[model samples]
Target: MKNVLILGANGQIARIVAKRLLSEQADVQLTLYLRKSHRVDDLVAINSARVRTVDADIHDQEALDKAVQGQDIVFISNVDHDPDNELTQGVITAMIKNDVKRVIASNVLGIYGEVPGEYGRWNTEMLTQAGLNRARRSDELLEKSGLDYTTLRLPWLNDRDEVKYSITHKGESYVGVSGSRQSMADVVVKMIADPTYLNRESIGLADPDTQGLTRPVY
Candidate 1:
């Protein structure tokens, strides 16, 4: 069975990923790591044999290490908020220590100033330089950390039920200013199911129909 560890399990996208994995992938086991374990208690109770929950801060080295052990893939479902990139660095350290090589992390777009046109300007104004810098540093850490990684640079998100989306590589201009949370979760599930799908690549995600909008659909 493929073992998957999902950090920040309480996040909206993370929760969707968890449910999809449980329902769709019979051969996978999961360790849901989050600050408040109770947030995923329903999953644990329903899928007791395949699901385990860890309740601890991401900065807690001991708990983090315990969660990382014996997992085949680590899914970082939350964005890095620490200016120093300590959270991302901590995850990298734990994964290296445990010899787990594959990771899929969530990040924001425009980190490389890749968004285009009026949307780009509006996105920049919305996210600000400081936030983008922190996200950029996190992605840089993963790229250099020697672990197999795929970073999803997401656009403004919505709760739309549809799964329509597209991908663009790191240097390509980010397209479609807004995408659904379901679309992002779908990408995560795809990566988890097939490890080599987007190996070592940082890609941007968006809904094709949402392109050219001056602002997010939401």
Candidate 2:
């Protein structure tokens, strides 16, 4: 059985991931870690034997450690609002203590400021430059933490259903400015089920041939 722990389980992406995992893979043992357990009552309603919910703050090292223990892989869908990447730090410490490897995290594009052309400048100026430095710091934390991690740097996320998307590596100049939330969830599920992405890598996800807007239009 593959033991998986999903931090920030109450978030939109994590919520989707939880349902998809349970529905798709019978052998996946998922522990959804959320700050507020009551927020996920709908999920618990599913009542699958392979599902577990944890209510604790990720910053609480002891509770985080307890959650990380006996998990083979960890996925982070949220982080604290601190620019110092305190949440990421807590996760790294807990994972190290529990000897857990393999992490998939949702990050944003332009963390490296590698988006080329006028769109790159626009992204850095009007879009990602606001308060996203904290996210970038978290990305840096994961990169140097010596864990087999994959950071899915996302573009403007839309609520539309699944669409054809493309994945780009770090320093490749992020393309396809927007991506569907379902597409991101699909990639996360793929990463969880397959072992082909064991090495540390940062991926940029987007649709094709379009410059994303400042925010997703519902």
Candidate 3:
């Protein structure tokens, strides 16, 4: 059995991904640490023996370290209004302590201009300057930590129905401010399936070309 640790697991995207993981393979066990008590009835309904939930602060190094023990894969979904960037740093330290090698982290697109042009620049600035320099600093530390990790630079997410999206590689030119966006579920699938993504690399995702969007691609 593969032990999976999911930070911010109560989130919409995280919950969606957890369900898919359950559907894909029962051998995957999910340990979700949530800061808030999200009263999602479906979460309680869907979780049986495969998924476990715990209320803990990612900022607490002792608690974080405890959570990291005996996990094969770790997913760090961003916390809303996460002030101190504790999760990012705590994840890295915890992983090192636990000897966990595979980490999948979510950051916003445009941090490095994976999406190019003015709009992409705007997007990057918006996230980077959104009152969380600690997050950026934490990410920088994670990149240099020398662990097998994948940093997903996700695009604007929409809660639409299931749809496949495109993965934006480094050096790609993002169109100016026009795109339908990727459903959160698809991004999670892409991240979990691709084990090759690592500390030095990032991938930006959006609706695939086959879906045919009316707006420009960014």
Candidate 4:
């Protein structure tokens, strides 16, 4: 069985991805790591044999290392809010220690100033310069970490159940200002199922139809 460790497992997108994996990928086992293990009691109850929970802060290096051990992939659904990017760095350290090479991380759009026009200005205003810089630093650290990684730069997210999204590469301007959380979860599930997909790439995701909106779709 392929073991997948999901950090920030209680997050909305991560929860969706976990449920999808449980239903669609019978060959996969999950290690759900979150600060509050009780938040995932339902998942563990669903399949205790295939699902495990780790309740510890990501900064707990020993716990993080233990969780990463023997996992085929690590999915980070949380953003590092630390100004020093300590959270991302900690995950990288743990993955390296455990020799886990595959990772998929979530980030926000406008990190590279890739959004354009009025929407871009609005996004910048929303995130503020400091927030954008922190995200950029996280992506930069991932690029230099030498792990097989895919950084997903997501736009404003909504609860829409539909899974429709378009992708743009690193240097390309971001398309659309918002997308569904389901779309983001779908992309993560795809990458988990196929390790070679989008390896070592940082890409943007959004619903193409949401493009050019001065405000977020939420």
Candidate 5:
């Protein structure tokens, strides 16, 4: 049974990933880490022996240390506003101290300006430029952390339930405009179950059928 720790358990993607893990891997153990305990009351209400919730700030050394201990994989999903990459560093430090070696993290596309055409231009111009740069630095830290890691660069996210997606490597340009959160969650589970493409590579994910400047044709 694999032990999994989700750092940002309250977010939509993390919540979906947790459910998928529970449904797909019955023997797996889950540790959901969140800042607010009440945010995941529904998860706790499940009352399964395999599910555990930890309430702590991801940057708190003692708390993070306790969370990562005895975990086989650490999934980082920081939705909080971190412009300095501090949260990413904290996760790495805790993982190192706990001897946990595998990580799968969510990042934004165009960190390297790999998304081509007008779509790339629109995303770069209208989105959080500062946040993109900060995420790039965070990605750099993960690359040099000496631990097995996979960074997923995501496009504009929607809450659709579709699971279709396409992948592109670090240097390769992005394929489509929008990707569903469900597809991203599915990819995270895939990385956890099989680390065949691990080791600090950045992957861009998009729904193959969706193409436009923004989502919902607006």
Candidate 6:
């Protein structure tokens, strides 16, 4: 069984990914890292045996290191305001110490504020600025650390009354260029299955009438 560690166990999407992985694959072990020890409603479908939760903050190096031990893949889905967000830095170190090779980090667009379009309008101006800035800083720090990383930049996310949607990589411009919008579930599926996206690249996502990798190629 491949052991996978997910940071931010209570995140909207991480729960989805855990089930998809266990359901889709036969042999898998899931460890969820969280600051608090709490059971989430989203994890109901999954068996308590396959899923284990740990109370550890990534900023705490020793606790994080213990949580990351013996895991093959680490998914970082934490977004909180910590001084320099040692969480991102902790991932890099944990991977090195544990000999884990694959890492998927969640980083959104406009961290540099270089790309802006449709998505920007949806966000309250200042709120968008601070959010993207943190994502950008997280990405920058992770990339320089020599860790194999995949950074997914998601657009406006919606779970209300929507059928399905499409995702675009780093390609064409859309009405919502501010960033992409993808379902927490859908995004998790793509990341785990697609190894081509394994190292050091940012993906922009969206929810549309069409679904999966739909921006007409980069």
For residue 57, give model 2's deviation from the true position in Å: 1.6
Ranked candidates (TM-score, high to low):
4, 1, 5, 2, 3, 6
| Global CA lDDT computed for model 1 | 0.93
Error of 4 at 150 (Å): 0.4
- Show model 2 residue runs off by greater than 4 Å: 126-130, 209-218
**Predictions in order: lDDT:** 0.93, 0.80, 0.65, 0.94, 0.82, 0.64
lDDT of 1 by residue, 11-36 (tens): 99999999999999999999999987
Model 3 Cα shift for residue 22 (angstroms)? 1.3
TM per candidate comes to 0.98, 0.90, 0.79, 0.98, 0.92, 0.78
The RMSD (Cα, Å) of candidate 2 is 2.1
> What is the clash tally of candidate 4?
0
Candidate 3: pairs in clash? 116-174
How do these models rank on lDDT, best leading?
Answer: 4, 1, 5, 2, 3, 6
Tell me the tens digit of each residue's lDDT in model 3 across 1-218.
Answer: 87888887777677777878878766788888877645444665676677777678767788888888998888887732367566677788899988988887776655554455455545656666654344445556666888786666555665556565556665674322332333655555555666554345655566554223323343
- lDDT, candidate 4, 14-99, per-residue tens: 99999999999999999999987999999888888999999999889889999999999999999877889988999999989889
What range of 10 consecutive residues in model 5 has the weakest lDDT sum?
Answer: 209-218
Tens digits of per-residue lDDT for model 6 on 1-218?
A: 77888898777677667777778865678888887666653463467767788887667788888988988778887653444666777778878888887788876544554344433444426446666667677777766767777777655454453325444444544323322222645655665666445356655555443223322211
Put down candidate 5 lDDT per residue, 30-77, tens digits, no spaces: 999988878887876664688888998888879999999999988887
Worst 10 residues of 2 by lDDT: 209-218
Greater TM-score among 5 and 6 belongs to 5
Q: Candidate 2 on 47-131: residue-level lDDT in tens?
A: 5578888898878888899999999889998744566677888889999888998888878777788666766666677645654
